[model samples]
Target: MNVRSARGAAARLAGRKGEIWAAIWLMARGYRILGFRLKTPQAEIDLLAKRGPILAVVEVKRRASLGAALEAVGHDQRQRLRRAGVTLAARRPSLAGASVRLDLMALAPGKLPRHIPDAWKGE
Candidate 1:
């Protein structure tokens, strides 16, 4: 395989692994997972979860460091996530009326996953 394709595959595998870990962490903390790798016309949501009245739209990142993982989600990505969240909520009756929040789950090797709720404010 070409170097680029191999790298892409590795990255995707790592991302999916990170999402799984994040989901497990959330579930242990009483969050019910609603969706994983949900794709909207606006963008892709890595994870969607709920706890009480809040609907969490999660972005999972696995990087060399926690700070790098958090920084991986940039301005344009955040905007896309917001749009995707709105689209998903509108289409899913179960998600209706839940207070939507953007969350970041950062996973770095040898460190516990960090869950940052309400990670970003509206743009």
Candidate 2:
């Protein structure tokens, strides 16, 4: 429709593509994708993955550059994602005994998806 709306739609499409790419990359590295685009009342997690006894809540960001993507998820966002990961673990019986952590996947044009595991500090 409008230019702004069209740009927003395109951005969303690009973000979804980035997420799918990140998931595939993770799978190749032995991580099994459990979920994506999970939204709750408190927060939203872009992707959930498992590798052995580790369950990761991944935040996917696609931007003009890798640095831009990495900076997209700030301190507040990390805290929210951490909280969501905890909530996800608590609500899922299957994730019991698994260590839950926060991860980040940064994607940019002509670049590979960068997966940063346990990028946030938690108590």
lDDT of 1 by residue, 12-38 (tens): 998888899999999999999999999
- Candidate with the greatest lDDT versus the true structure: 1
Residue-wise lDDT of candidate 2 within 14-100, one digit each (tens)? Answer: 878888999999999999999999997667889999999999999998777767876788887888888888888888999888888
**Each model's RMSD to truth, in Å?**
1.3, 1.5
Candidate 2, overall lDDT? Answer: 0.86
Off by over 4 Å in 2: none
List candidate 1 stretches off by more than 4 Å. Answer: none
TM-score of 1: 0.92
Q: RMSD to the native, candidate 2? A: 1.5
